[model samples]
Target: MAGVEETEQVKGATREDTQAADREPETLYGISGSPGIVVGRAVVLRPRSDDLVRYRLEKEAIQAEQERFQEAVDQAEQELKDLRSKFEGDLSDTLTIMDSHIRMLRDRMILDQTANLIEQKQINAEWALSRALYLVKKKFDHIADEYIRDRFADVEYVVNLLQEQLSEHGQQFPTGFAEPVIVVSEDFTPADTVRMQSEKVLGFLTEKGGTTSHTAIVARSLGLPAVVGVENITERCRTGDMIILDGYDGRVCLSPTMDQQKLYQEYDRQHRAFSEELSWYIHLASETLDGLRVRLSANIEIPNEIEGVTYYGADGIGLFRSEFGYFQQKHLPDEETLFSVYQDLVIALDPQPVTIRTLDVGGDKLAIQLPGNKFKALHERNPALGLRSIRLSLREKTLFVTQLRALLRASAFGRLRILLPLISLLSELKQVQEIIGQVMMDLTDEGVPFDPDIEIGIMVEVPSAVTMADVLAAEVDFFSIGTNDLIQYSLAIDRGNEYVAKMYDPLHPAVLRMISRTVEAGHAQGIEVALCGEMAGDVFMAPVLLGLGLDELSMRPSAIPHVKRLLRHSTSRRLTDLAKQILKCGDGMETRALLDCYLASNAGEWRERS
Candidate 1:
């Protein structure tokens, strides 16, 4: 909370005039949610809760309260739509993020629960909103996937906006800024990021968020510097305090010295330039020095993300997360809706093959959406290892059939592949194949046009799948190794849990061995192997994966150029030798040491241009 001391004395100010500047400077650290750098005056914005009054509503007034809630939701949706429309051309990424928030605003689960509570409890709209939010948070709290759990932030932000509107306080940002200022808040949703873009906000500092948070993702897309989870930034500095937001390192330096400001300014300049330089690799091939070509693809979440894939010159969409449709919609998307979305994506990619994974949700994700009154509580003590993915689909035949039927119908439009998620045992894969055959037979009998030769693949995430990779590879057309879940299951460490995140290592000898085994087995069967996981995007691990003979690598679109750039400068012979040595190592630290040594020796070539 201390302020930085001025290195130079002011021309006319006395010692009393510089009392605030005399305090020692403090540097707060957090996760680098978005990468860039900026120095600006800090504007601490806190949500207004003063006008939130709680009073019981009479039975006759319940209808009015419900209508009031609807009005507030509508107002919030309009504000979001207007804000999203401002960024059209180069900021399409931001638009997609805003779409998610808009969907959250219209979620039937939230609206119905809030309205029901208002009618049954005879409480104020605010009270009912709080109760509904509590229900959503309760479900998220039990989620095993950390990324999915972060979605709860969207619910909180949407409810907050609705409450602000209903209270008639609306919302306000600090005004009269003489210059661009860094906006600091307890949290910033995607909507907040959009709002900041309309103002003179240079960057942002948040007390709570993660790298995968929608706010952070939008910040990166906009090239805005942002650091989140900095703990008590609002209390540390007042509005207009000079601050340096080091988004690359996730450091917030309050009241920086004159010298520090200049150094950061230069760093910021180089960072922007480096980012531009990486864009040059967008149209280049991902080929090693030995002339081996590796397929680089994009792991997309939404249909809109296809634009990014084309811009980045990705070979195709390696992983289309179909579950996102379920998450974004109020109820389940019908077969027609699903088919249309898939059709669009495949048509956009055209010649490049699109691999679509089926609906992969269980426990925390799907159970939360089921009506509490209709369905019994769907509980799982450990959702990650419980009935999920292929297992869940097998149990719920109709849900699985609808998705398969839609996928089959869409296959006629473009090159398509079906990917099964979280497949552990051979039996699970076989069960899925049986269902796929039945669907194909039904379509055949009905004279519906569909692609019968659509390549079927399985996601090798669970350890059992890795152990039985040879047999599983024979059962499927290909294998896509999901290293994130594999690492978690292999090491028995939940990366989502902060306490044990340190133990979650993808470079663990066991994990690498599983990858190597899977790739070899798939290749032995003349089937291609791809990796669609966090590790695939990580340039530092690119050499190892390539050397392990991965046929394809799929990642977020933004990461494609960096990974391709790294591959272009690398030699397969050198990488293969290093990987061989790494495989001989006993532990992850040893393997990491080998990798670091290689990178250090070849820094001149491996490092990206500025």
Candidate 2:
């Protein structure tokens, strides 16, 4: 079949005539999330493992095959390099992740390992390469953390270069579909996402990956609409299945008729107009009609997320989780490496305060290097109640000191604050301070540079932190309640456990009481309190938080402008009164009712509220 660019035009056809032609009724349409048409033959990229040595071969043929294998690796690497150079601006740091894998594949260690296997055992190059890759794959799979485990895909990519068998037949892009090619894959790598051409390719539908997956990230970056985490996507989708992918709602329609396609086209036009209208708020501030100030910042785990800070116009970074560096990392980064990452961030942001949360791991966020026997024997069945956060620091005092030293050193580069997670008792804060003082003294003796007066705060995630707020508030510089965890603990429901999530409520009276008391404790002691959890980013909760007398709020970087707009209409006095009234409410519904009234009242003003 001829590609779209090569299609024989209908007699005397104009551009309008081309688009107006009735889409073949057989065409399938997912919601057209990404709006470009791809006209390429489908080339499936997959990870398939095999026993290479099973292929019996002569020595000379094996030698020839080894050279072929090496050449393929070299060619694949060059192709990756060419792609990177071509897309340098939009995808600068992205290809670097892939390049690392290429480097490893071409590294001496892998080459030597493969050669040793080939010479030591009577195996062909493909066999040797396959053996080595499987070993490497196992090493990555052994990682307990999901993030690191995902890296195994990179390993499989380069290895498959040596053993992949691809056939391109009737896989060419469909001319009869409503648009162009749709990717129906079990999964997509970041590399696949980058190679996707905006003009030729329509959106992608993957069988796996949630909103945070790399596929979603690249799809959003490319302005292509996409639907992910769709079970049985591949089964329902054929090369020419008429499909529509509604990115706005994460829904996809398979095999729609011409009438259905027309309706979707109209829907797409409307949705695009609505999105454009909403985008105007990007440069706008988050102030409400009244005169009140509320801080809006981002929660970031990746250092590459500096774009999120500027893109969203965040007031500052509320939470820069150090756990990503510690947990996803295979080995503990030395003080110099840690300092370099922090220092680069500090210098880049300059005066904006970056609240560095010292490694919050051991259970849900456990690092690889943490001792095995110690983590299990001493750890809790519920790590939420186990040796994590401030307590883990106390246990691994040396690691804590190393991290503290890095934070201090980075502070000299810019405004830096420390946030300690899971500080249920005053003793944890006192112990942390003692360690800091020692590090400061050691730095002083060693003549290292760091701001000794960097403000340190506690994450009010535990019931004890809220219950003993007055006492804990006295010793800490500030407090930021982590409502995601606080709600879980207070309501006795694990958020991750879907069966119990329905019981989780941010508006719960106990949760509200904890937040209000923590805020009161901090303000009474002449300190500031902020909410930096998922709740902080909730527009509905913004007014409730303000009413609770909270001084600052932080959330996803994308949420800043909307929350800021919500705040502009609020005032400390009005919110304070609301907080007082909430204190008198009987249950979570009462709090929800108060929030509903305020939301309904201000719903008209914030053009893109919530």
Candidate 3:
């Protein structure tokens, strides 16, 4: 209402046309960083570009310039330490990110390289620091994994801190908004996001960042509505401009009319009420009207997400992506660091099992400092199909062994499952089992404590793996279908490619058949089969997955409650029947329509009951 103006007269216009013409809001779209909706004033945080001056220093001034760089590094390190201390009891994910930032600040790549460049190139500290950041960016640019590659944002944050320290123009967090406001910036660092007071900050809009960036991670952890990767949001938005941030659809609307404002307000109210209602199912068992029980678990990447798992009443962690710790550091993490992280995760969920996925990234993504320089970075044309996941582990035995040792050690704390990724052949599973055996043997010889009979599993992702699921199922303890990759590889459609992205469908007949085959194979072996994919999080797909006889559904934390409620309200027998009909569909479109109809009919029944 504050930003709205009176409607203007239009000749021969209907009431709807007059209402629509009251205000024509400009909308911007981006990647959803988190899920929610809010309307607030825009607070644009423009970057300070004037401080980053690039100029050569005289020979006599080089010593001072090098010293200045070190001073800046020391200050940046101290600032990160202070920030880390501030969030000591806060989210563990925030602290982990802070620790990574502190490590980056002191890493030789930033600290030594910047100082070295100042002395060698005889340039100002700002210029030399920028050069070091350029080198770091160049290295990260070649990383094939988008999640790992997005970590460049962390490095950029560290560099920006050093730059600010050198120029003595440190940016302050925008404050003193009378009302909650949406913060728009070129990009947000994890520190900036973590430091934001949720009561004052309605959401976030950024010009640069992906969902995997640390900034986005913090935002999601905070339960804030955020839309990242919006081009020129800071440039276009001005302070006090009314903004509508829709995290669900990744949309931002500027200067909404009275009607538009009322619509979104109702949407926000319903969303809040629905979220509150979902909490009622948290304490209830994830079972259908029939007596069939299903394990509703969470797929988490960081330890702090442990909070979400417990809050959402998940059975346990279904897929713990173990690659984040490895990619966050300047060098490969040793067994001790790896064990500490894993041990914390296991200890936190003592009775509840934590399934840890082994390093699933490709060799091309491991550009970090490897011991002895033995592991050379492969420049594969298509890294996804190249030496990655299980293949990379086998080739780099030592790397794989170290991780296995750490995981085995952590298993001593609580229920732990080791998941190997991309096992296309029986031989791959056999080789990994052999290495795991050797690690167990060594630990035995050393009189180290471990779970000797720890369960092992494989991510049935590749098409070959699906074909050989029965063979692999016999060897492994369980099967976790990685439908994200399964759909991509099965359809030969690169989900990242705009041209073929629409073709990459989880509801495709082949994909559902593949899931059915994997479930059947796992059932034949008498092992649990779980789906830990984007599809698993989808409420509509929950019935289909249940019908396919999946023992578990592992997805993001926020999605757990919705899926749980769906599971509890519906009958498994009905879901199974629906799945049977859907599997008969010819294509994804038809499958979707049938699923939609089923959901609509069910919703109508639910409405009548209410």
Candidate 4:
């Protein structure tokens, strides 16, 4: 709060005018890694690249250089082990991450390769390590999974540690700050983030990271406001510069004016007040005023998020993206590894159904190892419409069967359901069932314990699936509408493409029809219907989804309270009528107008009652 420096008053100019003229505000946008808002002075952390220098070594010095590299590796391992020791219990996920780093340090791909490079190339220890990192990064780049490719950051983190040790940089991070500050850095590792103290660090602004990166995961766990993937953020910001971080909108404002600061202060106050109000609804049941009950579940990517799910009062986990385990490590996860992860999740939330969606990676996104341990990338003109999801699973039966075995084995622990992604044909469903049956028989022959009556479901995303929903519904136990892809595929628009992004609207009549028809088809076959997508989490779309006869809504943990509060205040009959009116509209504009009018009329009543 006291970071903004005031300029001396000039002749005929006010202090505010002088300060405003001296400092110009600049804004940078990036991906929202966590949620919160903070205003503080920036504390920039220098990148490790600054300490890296490549120099040729004499042939006789190669052996000593290799020994130096080995020493650095040893030091890095000891540092990680010491850090791991600090976290002893209940923080199993954090410990697992540390263990992964430790294993990576000793891996032949990194350890052996760097040592070999130092001797073969006759280069300094720092240069050999950097080259080894570059080669390993090339392999990571070949990985089709974005989440898996991001793990390269973890490798970089290890290398950074070794680099620091090799350079003899005493300590890269500051032990303490004079006042609370926003940390701006080229990137942060889980190690760096774990070492941070919330009392001294107000937020984080980084140049590299994704929503699923380890750094982002740690930031969320720490309840820090972070905006990552901003280009040149470290270069743009300097120490002690006044800054405001808006994690909700992925924005960073540097050198803010008085008006901007005041406005953001007011916004922060309102957000805090609204959060306090929502806390009151966390323990309430998700049901309409007329007593039409619906399940509110959370969609999580990793096991560490289980704490947030329970804290947010979710009835269960609606959608667990299971592919993270597949790419969390260097090699494909074995059945036992998968089972361990799945079992932990099931046992933690016993009696509450946890719906785990199978691996949804393939098409242009698939990076598989060919014979001789070579990585190959699959080429596809249109990955979304190409060989992905169910198709890939069927083609790779060995992979598919392995996952089924893990899922079934974990079922014995607690409530678990298997949700398949992108099932467009009845044949795909049948093939999956056949494989499941064979796997179950094999498990029985092996005398492995598992649940015999495990429920199976499919994601209704493509238009073909919507058209054949009634037929597919008869085969599965439940239906989860993936509106994100449904809307995109139905409108022939790629939401990620800037050219047609504005055309991707969930309120479009065709999108609503697809959802309505899928719900009807599922209900006709006596199966429950749930919506798990971006639409389900939106408070504005809660009434519409409820009116469409969905039995459950799964969303991010943070959105559960607001959506539940909206649903609890409205009656089913009113929402159904509103849905019917909107469906009759001819276009997206008309539908949105009608929905907005309804929400406007009832918004105040809902708030006042709350």
Residue by residue across 1-610, what tens digits does model 1's lDDT show? 1111221321212233333757566788988988888887666776443644568888889889899989988988998888777776758778877777787787765788889999988888888888899887776776756567777787887887787777754554444444576778788778768666766788998888888788898888877889998988877865656789999999999878889899999998998887788888899888986798999999987887887899888999999989878777656678899999999988999989999998778734554454333223557677776777888789878878999999999999999999999988778888899999999999999998899999999999888988898898888998999898888888999876889989889899999998999998999999999999999999888888888999999999888998888788888898788888888989989988988988888777656432
After superposition, which runs of candidate 2 have C-alpha atoms over 4 Å from their true positions?
Answer: 1-79, 96-179, 257-285, 327-330, 369-382, 569-597, 607-610
Q: Quantify all predictions' global Cα lDDT against the true fold.
A: 0.82, 0.67, 0.82, 0.82
| Ranking of models by TM-score | 1, 3, 4, 2
lDDT of 2: 0.67
TM-score of each prediction: 0.92, 0.77, 0.90, 0.86
Candidate 2, 538: how far from true, in Å?
2.7
- After aligning candidate 4 to the native by TM-score, how far in Å is the CA of 74 from where it should be? 2.7
3 against 4, candidate with superior lDDT: 4
Query: What is the lDDT ranking, best to worst?
Result: 4, 3, 1, 2
Quote the positional error of residue 196 for candidate 3 in Å. Answer: 3.1
Query: Which wins on lDDT, candidate 2 or candidate 4?
Result: 4
The number of residue pairs in model 2 that clash at the backbone is: 29
TM-score of 2: 0.77
Residue pairs with colliding backbones in model 1 are none
Leading candidate by TM-score: 1
lDDT of 2 at 521: 91
Where is the poorest 10-residue window by lDDT in model 4? Answer: 1-10
Q: Give Cα distance to truth, residue 61, candidate 1, Å.
A: 3.2
